[model samples]
Target: MYKEFMQWALSSDDSWAGLILRLTLGLVLFPHVAQKLFGWFNGPGLRGEMQYMTTKAGLPVWLAVAAITVECVGAFLLLTGTGTRFAAAGIFCLFIGMILVVHAPNGFFMNWFGKVPSGAEGFEYHLLVLGICIVIMIQGGGKYAIDKLLQ
Candidate 1:
């Protein structure tokens, strides 16, 4: 079982497409993770995020912590092309939750012009990220990935 799991985890193609998708997703996610984890980019950081999640978002402390951990660790894994599928899966689920919980009422288009009364954006960005994650989950990490080395 362990061997099979490892094999599946390490399996990947040699195409550049995986590399491109992996890097794009990784890079895009990094700043968001940093904001939540390190307070960078004017983010609320750990404590603030926790309070908001538990209060405004009405999430349990454990789920908030898990989400933060997944965002931080998953972004790093995606960047290195290590555990690409797992990382992508985590991110995919995270975005799905975000869309359903936060963005669904705002509709599909982003509030580019601040026209929305709620000032909340839509799910278009989440959908795009979800699409990227689906591709990465299917293709694995492509060229220059650590998964290739492990295999």
Candidate 2:
């Protein structure tokens, strides 16, 4: 089942479109990780922001590092088509964790307006991204990707 899906996604001869998808996803996600790592774009920055989140969330420090690497560094790898599958898989895992830990509290509807009994959070958006990354992980970045050229 999985292999078939991957073959389908990579079936596109229009490598440019596939490349665009890979680049967009990778570039867009990096900022979120950056906020925790470098505090760029008004982000909280790693030392204070990430540490605080780790402390509050009762997660380990390495978890923060892993998330940062996957969302930022790994995404860059995806963009460059270097280890595309590995990077996409890493992102899939990270997004799944976020859906469970962070966004799940927001609830499926993403109704931060105190809906779903509050603290319900949401898994909707994070899950969506996770699914997409999972697809890319299995399919690869398509023919135009650096991964293909490397092969």
Candidate 3:
């Protein structure tokens, strides 16, 4: 069972697709992670983000913390093609939650042209992230991945 599990998790038959997906997801998510963790991109820093997510966003403190950690750590993992599946799964769940809890209420279209009242963006971006994550989970980390080295 352990051997089978390792085989499934570490296998990387297709390289380019996973490479593209992993890089894309990592690049896109890294900025958001930086925003929350370091206040880069004019985002709230860790303390501020925690407060806003828990108070305004109504997310539990633990969940908010987990989200922040996952985004930051997962980005690095995906970028290096190490633990890509786990990172993808983490990001997948995070985007899905964001869609359900935050973006869905805003409707399908993004806040393009600053038209939305709440100024919150829509779920389209989250859906795209989710799709990428799904592809990563299915395809593994491809060539250049640490998983390949393990194999």
Candidates in order, TM-scores: namely 0.93, 0.76, 0.94
* Predicted candidate 2 versus true structure: per-residue lDDT over 1-151, tens digit per residue: 8777544433434356557667878778778767777788898887876676588666788887777766877778877866677777788888788777777665577765665654555787676677767767656776566665444
Model 1, total clashes: 0
Q: Which candidate has the highest TM-score of all?
A: 3
Supply the global lDDT for candidate 3: 0.88
Off by over 4 Å in 3: none
Instruction: Return the candidate ranking by TM-score, descending.
Output: 3, 1, 2
lDDT of 3 by residue, 1-151 (tens): 9998877877776679899889988998888888888899998889999998899889998999898888999999999988888889999999888888888888888988997777888888888899999999899987799877876
User: Between 1 and 3, whose TM-score is larger?
Assistant: 3
lDDT (Cα, 0-100) at 8 in candidate 2: 47
**How would you encode candidate 1's per-residue C-alpha lDDT over 21-66 as one tens digit per residue?**
9999999989988888789999998889999888977889999898
RMSD of every candidate to native, in Å, equals 1.3, 4.8, 1.2
How would you order the candidates by lDDT, starting with the best? 1, 3, 2
Provide the lowest-lDDT 10-residue window in model 1: 97-106
